[model samples]
Target: MKFVGPLIALMLAATPLRAEIDITEVTSPDGINAWLVEEQSIPFVALELRFKGGASLDLPGKRGATNLMVGLLEEGAGDLDARAFAEKAESLAASFDFDVGDDAVSISARFLTENKDEALALLRDAITQPRFDQAAIERVKAQIVSVIRSDAQDPDTIVGAEFDRMLFGDHPYGSAIEGSEDSVAALTQEDLVEAYKGALARDRVYVGAAGDISAEELAALLDKLLSDLPETGTPQPADIEVTTDAGVTVVPFDVPQSVAIFGHEGIARDDPDFFAAYVLNEILGGGGFEARLMEEVREKRGLTYGVYSYLVPKDQAALYLGRVSSANNRIAEAIEVIRDEWTKMAENGVTQDELDSAKTYLTGAYPLRFDGNGPIANILVGMQMDDLPIDYVNTRNAQVEAITLDDIKRVAARVLKPEALRFVVVGQPEGLES
Candidate 1:
């Protein structure tokens, strides 16, 4: 009954999607920097701000302070209570989203050109003057606890958690950013205050803005929006060299299908061979139906309904991870096939046909990511956080196109480690053990 699936297929078959974006760098008089893309066709603006050192900046033993504090940013700020703040934003026809990841706290705002100033003022107050009232704290805490409980009951979450614990041990990456129920229950107002000061500061902010704003106006707007924040935040987390034990760790769950997550040490984003590694992963596992893992495990053998792998180049560490799920009776066979494909990719590398296909798919799909001003704004911020140059959007495809078979071979030999893959399977999997 859904036409969306066929409509997308028809549209994609009609033409290759691509974006032609021009980026301009702007700097505030007070020294804040941001990327700007002017699009006068729209009467709205999308702005994205990223503060590095997100939930990872939680003080020792305070696992979810930053996340909880971020949740409270719009609950109330200045004199406005939660409902009043929501009404104010609704009146201005503006939207704000605050999210925290392991590495950064992200704030995204969209507003009409007519309401830019008022919207920015409301957003600024939320960033700098959160109330964190005791009642709001209890409410958001309960919500977070509820989410944690829900996640605890998910088989996929169980697999990922177990895999991370076995791989990263005591590192912050090993745990969920949501914090445990006990941790969330124990957080005090003082802890939230400390987390806010540690995570949202001027020194680590990256910004991107698009639509309805010029360079001069954007530079002024940047200073007005962020100049009063704290000068610095908590220090960044230390680097970690990830290592994985080669085997399976099983957590029994009452399910008919077994869910497995596997990973090993991976290349850093800044490494020279990172582009090659990315392409290699695409050919080996991430290129959807065209990937070798899918061709072998799903097409030829029908071991599972789906399988995939990806490169996770985190700020402080890197991991090559993958996921697969299959009937409990066939889960062991699926794992064996995935491992065999992994070894083949590392030993023999990809063919020229695969390299070309991956390049074309990657290049063609990238432009689809810029489908809207909001996405463009978010992309700009992400590029800034990755330390990519302003021209990366224009040059990224060429980089992918220029990769050759030899580059894939070398990167495959260096980055892929079949023997080091660690898997955590959750289910009552038959013929498989921890």
Candidate 2:
């Protein structure tokens, strides 16, 4: 009788569950916009800062300058040399990294709250007064060259290099963010310094913080971090054109397993049909297990261990890709099956069951992305970068659920074009249809 009373109270208390997120939008005294989310559940904090004019802003003949610039930021800052910098970070039990992407450069840090001062100081020094030391420059160049040389021998890397070269054409996005061996060898310390001077500006910066940070303190930290930055810089925008090139391009490799990457141009992040495209993608290939590509290419035919497809919605242009691997003999068959599925989905539209399952997966699995501060921080930053409304994470599943069969058909037709697809295979494949 007493057990029954306790169970009833437990059930009643659980009914009023709610989600709490203490989000504070802080504009630094110096005018940098930052988002601070204070989470007391964990004794950790993370800082993410982004600057505009990323790799796309690299000048002609300096295709990889932005990447090189950010690379040196952590190598030496103020008086700390590379080894000292690394040791200090290690001693503080902090994780710090910086990367340059198509449209921005980002620096992120994660550390325990006890070591907050050290981590923040390091980040501030790295951002404000990066040494760009000549010795460090040379060392980083050598490392980049080593990576370029090694990656040249990898089939997947070769395919990517070719794809980017073919897709973006003369644009900066077409080029590898990491410069070639020749480019890296030609890069001087001055190049990195100039890139840093031009790209890292206070007005173009945005910061996101989560896990144990108040709004006022976060803003003060950001002001110190970017105190040396200029007020503004030239905003470089990327204009990517969709190329219609459908043909088989083989990169000769002696590897036993062939890697196949096939795709065409896709919708950008701001497209109105973006949600529809996302849901259609899941039914077609993005669902992993119940996807058509997996069913046809893996489970049914046993052609490969894994096969999947999705639209990689990016800042400028999106890319739709279906990737799989199989023995050299099975590559052609896999591509054929993928193309056939594409054509069928476009022409006949997806079945009601496929549509229902995709909606269910997208809706039911939505809550998993909100489990932690880290994921929320990432999603928040991405939305900010893409110029999306702050309600994106909240309204995303409703958007997905609203997609009808006609919406799927319309998006599928626009998103998939077999004749425009560029076929890339890294090894010899059987059934040699192409």
Candidate 3:
């Protein structure tokens, strides 16, 4: 925690909450694209990079390759061993995070502006020349296997895994990114190398930077840092329409409570009605305590402590998903209430009051996202990935405010399908039948 205070001060002292954001799109000399938010007040910079087709790019029988590869990035790079890398980063007061998901590999970094060149060169080594030493591989592999063992015993993980199997069939989305313990233990140095190549190529990369940098400097930095990556890697997996098997699929475990994941297909991110669907989800289950599902399942009936639902629009597919937990004997009623609310929302939609409240809250909360340079950079990259216009920050609130009550009703009817709602319950619930 010794480093926490300075990082905090670096970000908050030049906060840009409720201020105009000027985004410039820059194309590096090597044809890499990046979004930049120049905040020169602080001698700090935050950089974010994403490579699409993340864990999904794993080769046949090589599940977890991308995940494992990402974990090894900072372990050793160029001539530095893991300890040397750690000491160097700390000496420079820099931080780096490497992560992967089903759709993308993400890297986030922050360093003092004065140390930009050194920090970037170090990062470039990690990105382009990871050693993946034999010892580090074994050590990280053991850690991942440990997590797989722990996840096996967790009800939340158990339920979600079963749900994905039912929902995605043979698609990569059906499998865990962590892979199985056997698959991970079998991974080789070559597999990690292939995984790294497939994941960090320029063709699928998106970059965003903020704080203490000029546009020309950022462009030059991008070229120097990323020019070594391959132009292309493995091809993305085929797109699959969601598999909706609408019924309760019970994975009975001896537990005191029942955890369930439910929902069906969802709208895409680029849909013209996406905002409407977002607003509708907030009204239905995505919002705080005032959301309809919470009002019905927790506030009124006391079936569970909390319930939440969100729209998942992935690069390959989309779905509306939610989770709830209750005492084994009571989860059935909770599901019943949730289903009822879903049907009601589809049929009747939201009232003007709900619409107005959601708009106000959604719009008001939007600005909080731009409070600091790190978040601003993250937002910029996400916007580029989502194919949003550069002026999106300025126009987003207006779009949310533009949604009408009729729009919500139409999107609700289109998105929520009660008959196709599948619930995967993991536990021993007395009165429930699959």
Candidate 4:
């Protein structure tokens, strides 16, 4: 035990560290803005672009249109069909990925310095002039429908869906990112085009670039890439309260083990006590083997293989959530233990030793995240999305270090409400009932 810290320090020091990132805010000639980190070490560049509204822009009945549109972005564009577009990208050794989540549609592009111009042009065409061909649209729609059908039969998926419905009611946040089969099947080519425009407009865009590029060069590239997008998007989703009352919601499935998802309302990313709460969460459940939940639920009583909790701060609402799985007869006991730990954490707080260990691990593990261009660019964009300061990377460790036992106690009392926890259990647990 005495040698643990020193061994960890040595291992961390042995790993190569990237140089301090100097991020530059660049404004394109067309008034579009992006964050740029100029790293000349590599002969390639990675760009991450995000449109803020994402699938939330889907109108009342068009829940899955944004997801389908994003999938078709790279399928075919301009004069290139699907096969030709893929072949062109392969010849230049450029890679483009487009994905849609609840809050954003993300485009990640990697290209060699020599082929940057051609690569950017191809990407621009994909984004601005996607054909939305009939064949490609049907093909992608079938694929999405297949996934939705498969999820309907999954226990975890059912629990998550029911949990969201309980929390948000009829809000867009309650719906699946890939809309249900009925909603998706009714969508048409016109709906895809409309969602495409509404979801990827310039007003909601955020950009980050890293690798062999200069701020001036990135500025021009940003314009060429984003200038053609619509100037504004549809209205953003309004913030809604997470309205889940405290209770057990049992969704019966005939499985040998029961899966449970439990949580209550959470703090936002920019909340003043977020760091303290972060450390407190680490002590409660986020610390793997070192966490109270894992120690008490998995190691002490052997209730389940693992247990964990985390902060889910979304754009509209927040949640403090955790998950565990156990034998049908033992799942109820595991939940009771979890609640006991939750209550204890809020009332008694963590010990000084727990605080110290959490800080050490968090601060030590942070610097290892910036090992490459893609990761750095992604981190920069994420920081911006979270409304962090430009120098957040340098100050993050200090923030962790500043958290005290008293700080954890205060944040724990404010953020954790043991009595408010709601559990959504799936499967026939012998000792539990809704």
Candidate 5:
């Protein structure tokens, strides 16, 4: 008998990881659109609900209310107090959570199939009829105010906040989604109520479900979740524009290290050259270890511990950002290096090897995004929120694979502008009088 037979057979029979995902477009009977995929391997289920207008639609003078409202959702609902809610969830071995971001708000739940109905009922109550108890409301508001107070003491936080204020000016996007100290201090229960009023609109909600449930059952659950929601006025999208005046804007803060955040606007998600733009960034700073910014700024000169650039995309506007940290004395040199790299990339684009490697990296990582039901459900919700094509999940890798060196050069030329750089330094630069 050959004792090694079982191990060899196992090795030979193993399946290689798949990079292509089959995401099916699904619609609820009540007219809500979603993307659903079934996985029964685990005896668990997950539901994620995303709404279009996130913190962006926070009513004027009530900044941070959206975040506060979501935080308070699980504190109490229906007849359960915060403690009672927690006890019930623990007993059922389920999880319910909510989060707010710049462009959307999400409520999610995970539960064993054995306790699915109880979890669903609890989640429905939280979304449709949150109690917003006054005591818990004050407690959360105080916590937010304290965090805002503490953030003000940080030099990086100071620089970033001031940078947004300068870049966005009077736009709603410029304001902190979590809000300022004054705003958070002034927030009350009425403000939370009003925020929920706008946020829970039926038209504003999009639901995604993945697990051991049929499309029909999910549709019925979605209706029940949103039925009590008022048909309140929809959130009006803002008209955001980015303007960068080329000069170093200095905001002096007392710190040993200088924090620099550089750059202006970048291409939006829907831009025709979005793929090319992504590749251009990968060569410049998006690639973690092999990026030009890291090789030149950190590796060669030892000017900073970390220096990288990225694109932050939004519904109507997007921004390009680069950060570097060095002693106050070497701050100007770091800034010059960043600017020179920008000019160099703009004039002469990436090499073919670099371009190929970037494409391969993006394509290889694409399939890892669908490793589990939670990630798959999140992707489905994102595509629906952005009104992306149903086939986007399947076709995205092909799109990346098809990009060429010429495409990289074209997009780099358009996006990388040293002259348009909006340089912001938040600490005192040595040898320069303020």
Candidate 6:
């Protein structure tokens, strides 16, 4: 579908600064609910679906089952084989993507309005009636197993796996989303089917749609696409505490560069202090070259090319985490610098300049993300997942702007624990000991 001048004007007219995004809360006749943003001029629709409790729903001993099932969804479905499914989607000028993450199985579809029915029918088949053919299963399994094998040897992967294990302990979050070698190798067709049933269910689903579709049309589409699924999934995993202790653990690897992942417990997304912590994080590590970690570690000392930190709020737990790579000989100094910065931030808080700059960048960069139909759809779904209000897009910057220096100082002291910081360093660094 071609977008002419009128559509182009409509698209560019709503800048992020204007807070003009009008999001409609849509409820279908069949009782399905979704978020929608109608843009009729585009003559296309972008639909985003998320089945919450994603890989976390993997039953005991079926670690990578959902991951594999997600890959196979588009590989074959209903009467169509893998090749036939690809050909069908291509012929319809539709795009379908299925992916499984730690928290959700995300499916995205884009279809021209002219072929919306056919495209959605194909997508529905892929979701509700995936064939999971043996040949296709083996092919996709081999691909995932290959990645698992590769990740096993990668230093960064090793550090992350060990970090999760150390922090989450026996919780499902500790396990790799793509399952380990033995686990993936042992996953059977029955396991995949069971995983599919447990992961994709009506009660746990969240959806967002953008582009040419209206609320009424989206309601019907929602029911048509997902109504066949079971209403509930199996019991979800329990909430976990980030149990990482203060100190460092060095896994000796024969490499020239050392990779470190460090953090402690983090504030929840809904916490009153979350906005303050968010701004503090941006000043500390999330702002790239302008951030404290970057300026002190990389730009000043040349300890590494990059260093970063972020708040990871999962369904099960929340964490404040960061990563950095440095020459094995210089890693100890880098770790000390990171620890010192953590202490300084926790004790001193950020200045007004830093806070204002963070707010500007955070607010300015947010609206740019809604540049397309698909991204808007995705964002809408994500806001729902985060339990954000319908008018969050308009109000998000105000929340950032309201944070004061005292707020950052108070939240930093509460959330950032310098003594509790744990570093998982992978590589044989000269002067550091665990």
Give me the candidate number with maximum lDDT. Answer: 3
TM values, all candidates: 0.95, 0.90, 0.98, 0.95, 0.92, 0.96
Record all residue pairs in model 5 with backbone atoms less than 3 Å apart, i.e. clashing.
none
Pairs that collide, model 4: none
Q: Please, what are the lDDT tens digits per residue for candidate 2 over residues 1-434? A: 33533432342233221144445778879777877667765666767778866888887888678888888988989899888998888777777889988788888777667788888898788888899888888888888788888988888887777777778887887778887878777877788777887788876776777776778777787777787787776567666776857777787789888887888888887889988888888988998779998999899999999988878776667789878889997888888888888888877778889999999988888776655555556656766777876666667777887889999888888888878877888876665534
lDDT of 6 by residue, 1-434 (tens): 23333443454444232246899999988788899988886677889999898888888877889999899999889999999999898778788989988899999998878889999999999999999999999999899989998998899999999999988776779889999888888999998899989999998899999889888899898889999998988767889877667799999998999999999999889888888898999999999799999999999999999999999988889999999999999999999999999999999999999988999999888887888887889999999999999999988888898999999999989999998999999999879888
Better of 2 and 3 by TM-score: 3
Tens digits of per-residue lDDT, candidate 1, 96-211, equal 99999999999999887888999999999999899999999999999999999999999988888888777667778879999999999999999999999999999999999988
Q: In candidate 1, list every pair of residues with a backbone clash.
A: none
- Candidate 4 stretches with Cα past 4 Å from truth are 1-16
Best by TM-score: 3
Cα lDDT, all candidates: 0.89, 0.78, 0.91, 0.87, 0.79, 0.89
Better of 2 and 6 by lDDT: 6
Poorly placed runs, candidate 2 (over 4 Å): 1-22, 431-434
In terms of TM-score, which candidate is stronger, 3 or 4? Answer: 3
Which TM-score value belongs to model 5?
0.92
Our model 2 lands, by Cα RMSD against the true structure, at: 7.0
Runs in model 3 deviating more than 4 A are 8-14
Weakest lDDT window of 10 consecutive positions for candidate 3 = 4-13
State how far residue 229 of model 2 sits from its true place (Å). Answer: 1.1
1-434: candidate 4 lDDT, tens digit per residue: 44533533343233346546688988989998888878776677879998897887789888899999999999999999999999888777777899998889999987778889999999999999999999998999899999999988888888888888889877777889899998888989999999988898998888888888899999998888888889988889899887566679899998898999999999999999999989999999998799999999999999999999999998888999999999999999999999999999999999998999899999989988986667777888888888898888888999999998889988999988987999999999887888
**Error at 185, model 4, angstroms:** 0.9
Error of 1 at 433 (Å): 1.4
Clashes of each: 0, 2, 0, 0, 0, 0
Return the lDDT, model 4, position 298: 94
